[model samples]
Target: MTANLHLIPLLPLLGAAFSLLFGKRLGKNVVTLVTCGAVAAAALVTLQMTFILHHDLPPGGALVDTFFEAPWMKAGDLNLSAGLWFDALTAVMCCVVTVIGFLIHVYASAYMEHDENYTRFFAYLNLFMGAMLILVLGDSMPVTFVGWEGVGLCSYLLIGFWFDKDANATAGRKAFVVNRIGDFGFLLAMFLIFYHTGTLKYSELASHIDGLHNILWLGLPVACFAGLLVLVGATGKSAQIPLYVWLPDAMAGPTPVSALIHAATMVTAGVYVTSRLHVVYEAYPQALAWIAGIGALTALFAATIGFAQRDLKKVLAYSTISQLGFMFVAVGSYVNGSSNYASGVFHLMTHAFFKAGLFLGAGSVMHAMENEGDIMKMGGLRKHLPHTHATFLIYCLAIAGIFPLAGFWSKDAILGGAFAAQWDVKNAGPVAAWFAMHAGKIIYGVMLTAAGCTAFYMFRLYYLVFHGKFRGTHEQEHHLHESPARMTVVLWCLAIGTILSGFLGVPESILPESLHHFGDLLGEWLKPVVGVQLHEESAGQFLGFAFVATAVSVAGIGSAYIFFLKDDGVRAKNFVATFPRLYRVVFNKYYVDEFYNAVVVRPLRGLSRILWKFFDEIIIDKLFVGGTAAIVNGFGKSVKYLQNGDAQRYVVGVLVGMALILRVSTHYSAAHAAQFHVDQDGHAVTAVPQNDAYTTNVRFKVEWGDGQESDADSAHPRGLKHQYASSGTYKIRLETTDSRWQTTASRSETVVVR
Candidate 1:
């Protein structure tokens, strides 16, 4: 059964390939069937695998299957192979990705029916699902990177699905470029890990983390630098503070894309990576502190931005970032003496349900309104699109952390984990204790505030869009109708999920004594992979935190009702007018985009222009290009002097060259006359002695530049007929000796071989 794990992702990949290659030919209905069927089958396979793993596998055990194995790469003692790892963590992720992914695909079919590029949209969605599955299931980091880059490519394609819009294409490019920055960190961390440990396999790296931690690279602990790099990569994919700007603009893609990629699966990849590598983080207290602090800050910061957004999808976009921050808070809460991996994953799961529901519900509303995304232009939609209104309300209540729903259980677990860290635990180290004492309180406070802001903005959106009088043009009002049954069906399914998924992570402290055993089911299921920890909070303490969270949510909801429902926008406008500067800043997303343009983008462009002008155009071109041309032209002119096109002058020059060579040879022979024995005719003597030896022999050998040599006797002492190889210099040597072998003379001269 584990061997079949490869099929889960392969199915969606095949669907994407088919849709991309033949979608137009197959028509829209067949395209939808292929895409949705692939995801649904994947979901079913995941469910079966989850059940089998639960029933058969022992606690704290995993099953690794190498469906296809080849030597991907090897360096010294390190080897990485492409494979799949199926465990409790992967099982949970598979369920979330495939189930929610299938639901989004189903919803997209109805939402995108009229679009000409509907098939292309489904193809991109399937590709994203397949890539995300590979990311979760890959047994090694390098293999996972293949999927990481795959999803990034799919994101660019999907985000700019309507390439006719410049803004959409620009948004896609922004997402790709920002993610590349994070991926650089990811690639570096992988290299450092491989350098130290000589392997990138997840299991090997996990087992060797302790041994490798002390190995420093660039004067920092390997764990610290590598862990921080991983966090940097997470910040980009998970939409944490500095790298989060791309997500809100990603709403330029279709609404289902917003639901699937941004809200549910892709954005949660950073949390998954962090959770998957819990061992590395657990060892570095400082790294854990950074994760906690950053998570808390990003959570509060994004939620505050959400307060002023008028665009419906943009509001949900910021809301996803804020909720992801809460998950990171759970991830970073290890300083409390518990890793809280299960809590982070629990929130990831529940947030997927409610957030996906919310985004899809927004899509339903948009479908009805002819694509009006501004909530300020929408009102009193409850009477018109009752199903969408109700489902959207349920999503609001769930995400607002109201009791019994998914958000309340998972979010409170994280808050409780943060609170528990404040309690001093023996042997947990002073750093952990100090962080729990000092930073924990601040994190808790900020996260609590963010929670209230979350409820406020969500309800504010709800009231302004569904409760007040119609605020848009009459034509839009007339067009307001419930989405098709196909879309609403998925919304209702996700709504039920929002209501029920919370039970999987219910805290034992919050349950009655009779039901305490059933609580924390998610923790138990995940304990085999992530390890289990007892949070150990009393009933009173749990109740106290739960009450505070619920009160803040109710307060936010009440404030929204008062401002938008009862006061008819008078107080809201006055509040904005009173703090115009602050309102404008928040409304404009703190001008972070402008800040980046000024500090990073514009400077890079200016530097590139300078380099192009001075280095490329002036220095490189003038020195290399123009100088080479000038030198070649001068050489051509020098050679042209020889090409006078006069046959008599060319022959005269050759004869003069031969006379010069003979004159030099005669001068050399006269300089050493004792070595030359003359014949009776006063000519140079040449003889071949007995026993194959030469004595008093005056033989001349003429060598040509063609590497051919010929000997000339005393009768024919001129140069031999030989063809030159091409064009170059040649050397001519002469040797003479007396019969008594008393002296030997050798002379050499240079001549043109052309």
Candidate 2:
């Protein structure tokens, strides 16, 4: 079956168009219906297509549906089709983006009901959904980049939805500019890939992998160079480390938009893209390690930063970044002798469930607390918002990796894969072996710590907000109430997902021996697409990692309870009092943003000012735009003298112009532009004349200047020969004419016939 894959994205795009065009006239209710219905309908279509992909398609096959018979983009050797590619990987992403997007849409309908731009909000949401689906389903990289830029544009619009607020607008611009920086890397990688291989379709690129295998770019292997550039792009989209500053600020948008971005769309794009193009990374182990190291570091780094965040959304924002890092680690661990891409994607799924639920819960909390975001000011609201509290607790526990929850299974898959990693240090020097031997363990250890931090900050957010006495003002306290059914219904549904989603990916080693057949169905389902891991795990190794994972999760949760809730946070207070400097630093996000502002943002702004002054104002404006105008005006002034009612001067000018034109047209030139060979001890010469232009039909002749000449032979210009009597210097003459134009040109030169 063709699967009619284009309709999946088409539905939402149409909805966005309708919402933007006629939404105001139709009223908010109609806008909401079209918006949510479109995405919901797309989700249903995605489910149907996914079923078809799973049951009907052969292994390693796709159900492709192109929009037109001809290529959408064709230039010289480049041809790109407008099409949808349906495979196991795309199937998984479609479910995530469409399903989560639908939920966020439904939630937003209720969340933004009172907003003035409610219709516009839904329009942006639908647009975002459509673009993300395009990103997932595009048949080629250029097509994918269309969606890439589409989402980037939507992110700016959605993040700055409240344009009235200066900070919100700045945050949106920040996301745009930072993502552009990362997008440049993606663009460069595409250029390099296309340079080595003529096509950009995923299947075609895969087939042409060997063509790029041994090629080098800028002193590095092509694969390595491309892989590094790809990683740079992933870090920006996924919010890993240096490019991560934009995400925390993205909370300036509506909460539902935040859920959509964090769970469904933009952030997971990086991990998905890497998995989609794993062939590029297969030849470069160091590049793969760069991914793992960055992931491990970002996970730990973000988790540590999360510990000090007071705003509920900011905490989850950092938590999102940290979890994304874990996904990066999962995808990047191929060099560690494992291709746990399924685990990485699996984590993306589970994170969507728990994190979206968490963010929704935060939105719910904010709604009840009268829009208060700081958890430090929130306490004991569980009594008031019972449903929100229950779902929030579930999401919190799930994200903390409590057993039987979604996070545990996926996090366990990644860790198990990490532990099973085999470093190839054979035939290496001692230092190399030492580095290889310890690198895997070090990464594993950092991920473990990050996992622990996940539990710590999540529960810290939960306990601080839900467990203590009410701390807010009377007016805010009076406002506390459970959210409307429209919103809480989504919470409970996602809460159920947080509880049940993990079982689908339960690794066999974590289960009893009899349940082995039921375990890792996700891995089995995805194997045809992502392929099997590089290193196979023994039961003992997997089970061992699972055990440590549970222990660390429990320990982190326990630590949070003891420090923040057990004794009313007195130990936390004492610890903070003792380490105020450290606490302040972490609380301030290590001043990385400030550092960036000082080093990057400020310098760039300063340089931009210089460019605006010198380049834009002076060079472009004065020298180019104004100078052209000035030259035109001055030429007009100079030429007006000829038209000063002076018929005599006008006639002279016209005649002079005609003469120059005639001279240029009648110019003539010629050359032998031919080939000759000497033979018989330089006694004879044969020549082939390729006369220059205008040398037609008259004749072609040559004099060997050895007292011999050849007859004119324009009709048969190939052979007009003269024999040289001996090996010695001589003068040679060539002549040609165009009798019709009455033009003749000739050349003579000294020659040696030897």
Candidate 3:
């Protein structure tokens, strides 16, 4: 069974390869069936693997199956091997990938059947699924990045799958370019780790932390830098901060792609990365704090953006971002010295169920509308598409965290983790440390506010799309048939997951000791990876907290129910008419997008244009590039004088050079002799003195005009050969006058040696 785990992701990879290579010859329906069948087979195999894992592994055991390693790379001391890790986290993630992915693929087959590009869509979908599965099951970060980049490439292809449409192509490019921003961070972080640790293997890096952290000044700073880089990667993949602009636009693709990538699979990579690096973050709480802060802000920001969206899928996109924000919050809470791995991973599971359902239901709506997605044009759909309406209703309640549903369980668990994180600070009683470490009053407040907004906006979308009378033209209304049985069947299955998945991580308070046994199944399973902690909140406190959280969620639902479902006037008009400014602000998402466009995008474009015009074209050409040309020309002209080829002028120049050299040499030698005598005898040594320190003689062979050699054996007159017994100076003089034109010319020569 352990070895069989390798087959899970491989099946989809094979299916993708076959579909892409021979899909056109196979025909669209065959392609769809083949891909779907392959993924379904993979899901079944994963199910068997999970069952075996449950039966075989102990409470805190991980089943690591390294089936193959091709020795990808190895340097002097660094080695990285490609393998798979099918531990608790991998098991849970694998189930989600194959299961949810299979559902989405099935839904897409039916939803996309009308399109001519159905075969291509399934190929991309399978490829994307395989890449994501590999990402989760990878044993090391490099292996994970391979899958990371694979998914991004698949997303760009899928998002732009309908490339004939300009908007769709632009949306695809946006997803690609924006994600690159985060991928850059991931690459840089890998380099930093490789430089310091000399290895990229997760096990080796984990064990060598002490060595890396030994230089607090160097290590801490580098750790923070690396962590921040990884977070940037997370933000891009997960759609945080500036990177989130692409997700809403991503709806330009088919609704099913949006559902699969944005809701269930790709965006969650950030949270997965953060969790995988829990140890790295544990060593640096400050980085974790930053993570939590950014996540909380993104949640609130995207939720607010959801309020203003008119398109159904765009609203869900923002909603996905907001929900991901919660995951980040859970991760951040763990960083504050608490163990909320169960809570964060718990929320991740439940979120997948509900979000995937929501997206699929949205797809069904679009399918019925002849491809229309705006909620304003889609009223009175509940009665016609009863299955979609019913499934979507359950998903809405779950997502709104309504009582007893899966969303309520998972979401409140997250809030409970947030509260647990801030317990000591808020309690201020006996558990002061827990309170101080965990309490984030401001974060909780914002989260609660976002929760309210989520409830209101979701119900608003629900009512606008399903509750009112049909608003489309007669022809459009005539086409409003239910989605295919294949789509509906998957929707129902996902609705069940949305309804019951939370039970896997059931709060211990709900199922007391001896039977509070959900703990060992996932909590203990993930203990080796996420380090689960058995929460000790009293049963009474747990009930009280659950009750209050449920009450608040219901209140949000009730408020939406009254405003949209009951009072139809509020739905037609503005609910916040009394405060037009506030309503407008809420509708505009506080203009964060506009601000980013103006402040960030505009300036970047302007600077890029300026750089292209000035530095790249003008300065670079003129100074760095053109200057070389100028220097070459100047050298050519200066060397032209040497090419005159006049032998007489060359001879005169050489004689002048010889006279200058001899005069300079005589002056330097006399000065040296004078200095030696000045230092010892207070007089000059006019001859080569035997007692002097100058002993060795150095001779030069000179070349004169027209390549003629000077006579080396010639001796100066009057013992003026100038030899020094030691290292000192002497002068050589040839009798001559100082006049250049007296009779012929009185020649003189001066030579010096030392």
Per-model TM-score versus the true fold: 0.75, 0.76, 0.74
Ranking by TM-score: 2, 1, 3
Residue 296 alpha-carbon offset, candidate 3, angstroms: 1.1
Once superposed on the true structure, which residue ranges of model 3 sit more than 4 Å away at CA?
65-72, 168-170, 217-221, 335-338, 422-439, 512-514, 519-521, 575-754
Taken over the whole model, the C-alpha lDDT of each candidate is 0.77, 0.79, 0.70
Error of 1 at 748 (Å): 58
Best by TM-score: 2
lDDT, residue 127, candidate 3: 89
- What's the distance in Å from true for residue 730, model 2? 44
On residues 1-754, what C-alpha lDDT tens digit does candidate 1 reach at each position? Answer: 3457888899999999999999999899899999999999999988988877888878665667775554555556755677888888999888999999999999999888899888888888999999999999888787788888888888888887866665465456556656876898889988877777767777777778865578766765688888888898898899886677678878888899989999888899999988887777655656777787788877877776676688999999989999999999888886444477788899999999999999999998888889999988898999999989888999999999998899998889888777655433336688766755777777888788788878988998999899878889999988888888999999999999999999998778778889988988889888867765435577898899999999998988887777667867766665556434542344244345344224422343344345435533464345444555678899899778766788887998899999999766554442353222212112212221121222224454433334555555453243334444455655544444432333445555545533
Residue-wise C-alpha lDDT for candidate 3, range 333-375, written one tens digit per residue: 7533555666667778789989999999998898889878888
Worst 10 residues of 1 by lDDT: 682-691
Candidate 2 structure quality by residue, lDDT tens digits, 534-567: 2356677767777899899998898789877878
Error at 388, model 2, angstroms: 1.3
Arrange candidates by lDDT, highest first: which order? Answer: 2, 1, 3
User: What is the C-alpha local distance difference test score of candidate 1?
Assistant: 0.77
